[model samples]
Target chain A: MTTIQLPPLPRVAPALTCDPAAISACGADLLAASAQVDDLGTFVAGRARVDDWTGEAATAYHQAIAPTGRRADAMSLALRGVAHRVEEHSAEMQRLLDRRTALEDRQQHLAQQVAHLRAEVATTTEEGAAELQADCDRVAGQVQAYETDLDTWVSDLATEESEMSQAFTRVLGADDVDRIYGGVADPADGPLRDKPGAGASPAEVHAWWAALTAAQRRAVIAAAPGAIGNLDGIPASARHAANTVALGRDLADYAHTEDAGVLTDDERTCYDNALAADEARREIEGRHDPVTGEPIVAQIYIYDPAAFDGDGAVAISAGDLDTADNVAVVVPGFGTDGESAPYQADRAATLYESTRVLDPSATNASLFWIGYDAPDNAPWDEGYDGAGVVTESMAAAGGERLADTIDGLRASREDDPAHLTAIGHSYGSTTTGHGAHDHGLGVDDVVFVGSPGVGGDTDHASDTGVDPDHVWAGSNSRDPIADLGNHGWVHGETVFGAGLGDDPAEDDFGAHRFQAESTTRGGAYSFGDHSKYFDHDTESLANISHIVNGDYDAVQEAEHLHDPFLGPVEDPEYDREPTSPTTSSLTP
Target chain B: MEVVPVSVGEASRAWDEQHLDLDAAATQIADADTSGFTTHVRGAATRFLAQWQRHAEGLGTVSEQRADGLRTTIADYVTSDEATRGDLVALLTYTQEVR
Candidate 1:
């Protein structure tokens, strides 16, 4: 909303020359020339007064000397000579005036030059400030990454220490004697012997199981019914004890007498079925190609129930399209797949829900929930670095897929223009940028949420290959992952402008279309981490809904910059929510 | 002039080595699909040969001597980062196709 106003130019010396130094020098010369003119004028005026008095005295003397013509001639000749002397002084004054005029002109030129230099210096200084700010932003992004890594490491270490402490406690408890102990008296036996005067009596236990060897463990587990089944509630330590006992019993029974033979029809059937099921599941999962083998997770979701109006039941394949009134393709970031927990699904589902919430009357809308080729972890996936490289490639592929989908959709609905919006999160934002670059993925609006950085400059239209008029962004303060991504991960030198100017945390998302705050810090319904950008009812999701529904006024009214790097500030009403969120039926 | 023998991977390493002529070497190797040379690739040819050899062995094509021949020729002339060995395979395919 801020406008810049340039200062007015000041006139000093002559304006002929553009040099500031020359103008300054001209001004100085003019000042001295003017002073000389003033002094000379005063001197000439004084001399004129004295000459008038002398003439009067001479005329009086001639009249008193002789009434004859001889005295008159002498007086007239002397007066003529004085008149000539006055003429000479007049010529000298004219010459001074000419010199002063030339000096004034030079001074004006010098003045103009000085003004120009001042403006240039100011502009250079402003440019330098911008560069410094960019450097600061880059460093901040690095710091954010470092901080996240440190946090993860510390958390890991803490978990390990806690587990170890629990193990030590169990050992100590075993020596109390009140707790049952067997099997070579356990490792703590020696310590117990040193302090035997203390605890309660050991609980009675069958000696046969405690003496089981390591080989017995596997045999016992294999023979046991449902040994690994439905043991979710059993603590790991308890499970280990039960397994150990089972193994010991099995080994003694097998070694002592296995003469009965291996005839159990039910066991064979069960084993075969289990193996077949495992193989089937593996086939369904689809292994990666060995040559270009990279870990990736893929999924497909169908939204439409049936072929309405005799339209094809099949959705268009990649780079093909069937027309629809509204189509949205949501690209998720790293660590996302079909097996993702309810929390992740909820985040992804929010996009569809938010879109519907924005436009209740959009009945023909279809949303493609894409999780194709998403990695299990980041920076480990081959060809994926940041928004600039792998994400960009993903976007390129995704965009092609989207284009195909749109074309197929268009084929079904002849009247629809096939409006598409790409809503990407974190690394997905980079993919969105690459999609824009490919020019095949026609998008009306591009929104990035909880993004570290997109692989393009914030000048989205020109620099990022998207229409600068249709970019949106958001970030949250308590979401440390988003903050880290925004600060340290240079997605593509993207600048955003959605943060609160007062809070340093807000600036991390960069200057962009929109950055919304979570309802609470680290809220489950808000962007919680690197992956959950579209939590249920957060401001970030609201902004995305508004933009996708063609409610630019609503977004602008909210003071979110669509293209922060553009000219002119226009105000329009952007309702906090979409047009009519409840009209569409999403119950199925 | 004959182009220097350097893959992009090698050029990258050479740059790290602080070699003064690395830039020139990079230029030379950038488009060197010249006669009699193994196809210019982005990564090391030697690694590609090893990976393929392992694959071949697993597939029961036990011509160990032929594999060894390919590997030696590669190790002698190719110097590059092992991480991007696939690039070498791609180049070799191009080389065979041209031949």
Candidate 2:
């Protein structure tokens, strides 16, 4: 009369009541409302000082409407906060609901198995009953495990709901709104009281930033956006937010001052820089992600409009820097500044697209880092002064900054490092060389394109703090600037050259030189060819893309340049012939 | 005292336009749907929307009031100018008769 005990099957109901689409729609509406309110505030502020409406009444009107504008800003910020939370919650709810559905289906299957075993056990003979009992025990154990999993899932759902409520409470609190978005602190005092200084290491900065409360971070961004926007080790998304706020505020302030005809000379330069940055951001933002079909995310990694004495340092990324499998920093050469951001961003976008085309599954990000004060004039310019281009001072300084930036990237993503590469063009290659040689640029690969020289003292590719095999160079046959580097002469006579450094494309430079012939024009030498390395459908761009995608075997190699007694020689195996003019002194 | 009627009228019209924009923004925020959210989130969203609506409406009310104030001020200024002109004309007429 001994009974075979079985575990009871539990109920398998999953309540998934949230509609993701509706929640997303609500978030969109909230964002629209926020924008509208912002526009209203801007209108009120602009209209406060009407033409020919001066004197006591105008002053009173300005004073009276100022508070309304402040209120509008606060309200808009509050709406944005709630919208962000709601949107995030919607995504989380969808994931949880999916998991719950899977669990419920498993529960149903297990319940059916239990019912079948119970029915068999009731009709089986003694010998058959033992086998049926074994089946029952296995089914009961599975049911018990599923019940445990179900309990854990239920607990997780409850925890998520509770966290969501807390988040909403924090977002909707009135004090938080006024304190965070009210712009209560002075800009000169910096954003947060305890924020790391410029001299702090990236790791220190990252730690300091991670320790702040969410509200505190928002307050800091609102109070001193320029400071936070350019700080290294801050997450790209946060930097983007801070930089965007800074850009808008600066533009508005500059526009107001310009309208009043009181803009200073320095302010005018910064204004142009701001406009350029905005144009660059707009260009990237207008592009659609190939995979997601959504507007591409552009991060303003660096936004210092007044840096480099108004040459203006700026870096804009074509993808998410925080979470990408591969990352490349494209450093432009001479004549680059904030004004060059649009073109640089285009180049970065092209490189990004090329990487995506090469490998569709892998995530990639490309940054147009015009972080240094590049020489305003090229060495090949008609009346080129030897002040900036002929010397390696600018490159060395820029290299230091580049090293810091790369190090910051490493520190920020220490948990999951990316396949980082530095692609330098023209004098940027020199800067990159200096960075790797002098400062140990912590990148997996170094690519020098149309390089005049890597650095003044870097004679070998191995001197660039990377394996000589990993160092790559691409010099268009007709690129005059690429020929500015010194090549070893024949007859056992070492030539003391006046170029920036040893030519990376030379056979003795110990760097892999790739085919970079400019097919756009058939000239013996064209300055335009130097700029064509990054052009689409070009062998040079393809090779660079292969290197960026970490597919080194796919790269097409080219013959290296060698200096002979008669003239500069090239291997006949390569189809393109060297077209650079022969010169005794390679200054340019 | 030296207000230009054209400028005052333009300012008043601008305020009127802004008032409409603010009102529309307030309505948009207040009418945002929270029906798809779970009970706890929906409740929070409703409260937040209601509070933000008040703020927006408050700004809208200020805009409307400013527009009204500007309109009244311009009208009063024009009326005062007209009265002053009439007094000057009457004075000139009375002086001419005396002469």
lDDT of 2 by residue, A1-588 (tens): 346665577668567688876786676556555655665655766765565667787778778878777776676666666666666777878888888888988888988887877787677777676677788788888888888888888887787778766765664655677777785332223336677766999888888878777767764564456666777788877787778766755665566456546567998999999999989988888876655666667899999899988889899998889998999999999778788889998888777777766666788899999999787665566234235776778888999999999998888888889999999999899889999999999999999998888886788899998999999999887788987877774211134433567778988899999877755744566788889877766778778878888999988888888877576656432465433211111123
Model 1 lDDT tens row, A44-125: 2232122222233334422422221222122212212222222232343333335445545544544464454445445555
Model 1 interface RMSD, one decimal: 49.4
User: Model 1: DockQ against the native?
Assistant: 0.01
CA shift of B3, model 1, Å: 51
Off by over 4 Å in 1: A1-324, A341-348, A364-366, A378-414, A456-459, A484-512, A522-532, A556-588, B1-99
- Candidate 2 stretches with Cα past 4 Å from truth are A1-191, A378-386, A489-498, A569-574, A577-588, B1-99
**What are the per-model numbers of colliding residue pairs?**
49, 0
Q: Which candidate has the highest lDDT of all?
A: 2
Residue B52, candidate 2: Cα error in Å is 11
DockQ of each: 0.01, 0.23
Error of 2 at A181 (Å): 11
